[model samples]
Target: MAFDSLGRFGVWRGYTGFSPEEAREYEQLGYGTLWLGGSPPADLPGVESLLAATETITVATSIVNIWVAPAKEVAASFHRIEAGFPGRFLLGIGAGHPEHTGEYRKPYDALVEYLDELDAAGVPAERRAVAALGPRVLKLAADRSAGALPYFVPSAHTAKARTLMGSNALLATENKVVLTDDTNTARTVADPAIQLYLGLTNYVSNLRRFGFTDADLAIPPSDRLFDAVVAHGTPEQVVARLTEHVDAGADHVAVQVLGDDYLPALRTLAPLLAARS
Candidate 1:
């Protein structure tokens, strides 16, 4: 499976212009993949440049919102990348929040249709994944695509997702990490990122499934909830928290380092994570 090539860890970043130098650095540091988030366009605008810049690192979308990026367009983009980079790109698609999507209705059915279109468009099931947060979609991803790439979830959720996905699927969990030792600093780095998801119903519902209460789901987010969802501390301590996802069931953990810059944290954690994975 292409999942094997993903090593044991990958870097997750918001969709933006990828720096060739930064990408090369990620490869040198031993991260197997660079996951682009924030729902990239159907053309997959900056992907080729990223792939061309690095030799072996897999560049994947953390998610391309199905509602925004049509199946055929995304499928064409996938083929274009495959022709040039071959096994270097992975298509990650998802049904974005109803709160944000104007035409959001029957998301599960919509996702099935999108997958069907991708199938007709000739995108291999093995080369794509679904950004699922619930059991039904998780199973859909496992049965129909590569597997689930769930976000805003804890290690406990990883264990449950693994059960639903069975044993052979590529279960890559997205984990947020703040590379700091002090509690205040960690919260300072993580709070802004956490606040956004707290308003999104999908993430809130998922957190509740894992036993978090309404208080935990507040606008500012309770410290207990923040601690559970975001791994924060020293590099070693942060790595220990991230390892929990792998130990629970994640085949690969996509580390989303929260801060002003990602390189410093990536550099510090790379060797430590390489030793563990």
Candidate 2:
């Protein structure tokens, strides 16, 4: 697998927030990949647009939910993108949460079936990844796909994922960043950002494994829980915290900046993260 093609650090955000021109700008800023968050559709034309805009930087879906998007259609889209932009696209797919999906059932089995279809449709195993958090799914990711893309997790979870996946599989974890010095302001910005995930069992269960208690996982989330999951500080401090993920085991850190704009945080972080790379 050419996991090295995706550099050590990348940007993560909603696809709607960026344009083709903005994607080129992120590439120029030294980010190696652009992860489009949210469960995108099977026909990933937006992914194609980002690929067309950037030269070397990779563009990937944070996840294309298996329940909503059929494997055959997704495989067809993968072929379409690969024909025009070969090594620049990575398909990240996942079995979405039960609360969000009306037909959610046996996620592991569904993911296995989806992978089988992708394989039959010729979507190379090395070109795709699974959004996994638990050990069972992480092992499945390593056994079936190129890697695992875990979201709403801390460095502790990243370390666990690496141990579960073994050394060979790629471990790309998302780290939320809020650029600020004040603790109250940082948590204020980050609390609402993760409000949706706190209610989700998958994410809450993962946090529990990391030692977060029921009180910590409350509606507003304990301060310790918030701080641990979201890196909030000055630019240099945020970089330091992000580096902890790489130190723990993450091959690539997909940074999700929590603020009104993404470009400013990306610009501030580009040089610091690039220096480490």
Candidate 3:
């Protein structure tokens, strides 16, 4: 079985654009899964509605924060949904940011403990995934969960992760793609989108491992910095650029189109939707 039902590619939406109607279109458009980002509240009504709306698209939490929801609540939600949606759900759980969560310490150990709780609660291992970055988390993700969904990482990091996870594990990389064609202007807008992530330890650490220096990881991101993180240009050009991650070994790529207007961007990326199997 595919480690992730993602089965090679998906779309990453900020959760605002996932209307009932648009979701139906997304499934028809051939996006195998939809990764909902942000710390959406534990209820996950959005996820349930999405799973109900689409026939094939997998509705996943890019990460459901372990601190906020707790394993018992997540397990309850999983049972409620799985009974109705079955294979349409995938859980992506992680220990989130330090400043936001407060109890931030030894994320790996915390993550493992959380997974253990989920396991004890009877949420099957195959139905869930771990949000990871760097070698240790990647290894833990492969060893304990179905796979890893790494966010804000580039092809170089994907290549490195592929080595760590080995060939059997799922490598679903979240790549930021911009539909805007303008070089300087697009990068300018994309910079802010990436700026928040720059402060994230998981993201910054991954970039460091990928060989980016402090200067490169600086705020307001330099031109080269923007280019490295955001896949900008025409649809096909961006598609070709992102393909490098797949060539390196990513089993799936969740393309997050930047600059807010996702409907048009999703249309622009329509051509590549069929690539998912």
- List RMSD in Å for every model shown: 0.9, 0.9, 1.6
Candidate 3 lDDT by residue in tens digits, 99-130: 68877889888998989988899988878888
Candidate 3, poorest ten consecutive residues by summed lDDT: 1-10
| lDDT, ranked from best to worst | 1, 2, 3
- The runs of at least 3 residues in candidate 2 whose Cα sits more than 4 Å from the true structure, single-residue gaps closed, are none
TM-score of each model, paired residue for residue: 0.98, 0.98, 0.95
lDDT of 1 at 76: 95
Which candidate leads the pack in lDDT?
A: 1
lDDT tens digits by residue: candidate 2, 169-266? 99998999999999888878888878889889899898999999988998888888888889988899999999999999999999999888568888
Q: Give the local distance difference test score of model 1.
A: 0.92
- Kindly report which residue stretches of model 3 are placed more than 4 angstroms away from their true locations once superposed: 1-4, 273-277
Candidate 3 has an lDDT of 0.81
Alpha-carbon lDDT of model 2: 0.90
Please report, as a residue range, the 10-residue window in candidate 1 with the lowest summed lDDT: 14-23
- Which tens-of-lDDT digit does each residue in 1-277 have in candidate 1? 4787888999999889458788899999999989999989999988988888899999999899999999999999999999998898989999999999999998899999999999999999999999999999999999889999999898999999999899999899999998888999888889988999998999999999999998988878899999998998888899999999999999999999988767899999999999988
Task: Select the stronger candidate by lDDT from 2 and 3.
Answer: 2
Screening candidate 1 with a backbone cut-off below 3 angstroms (N, C-alpha, C), the clashing residue pairs are: none
User: Residue 248's C-alpha lDDT in candidate 3?
Assistant: 86
* TM-score of predicted structure 3: 0.95
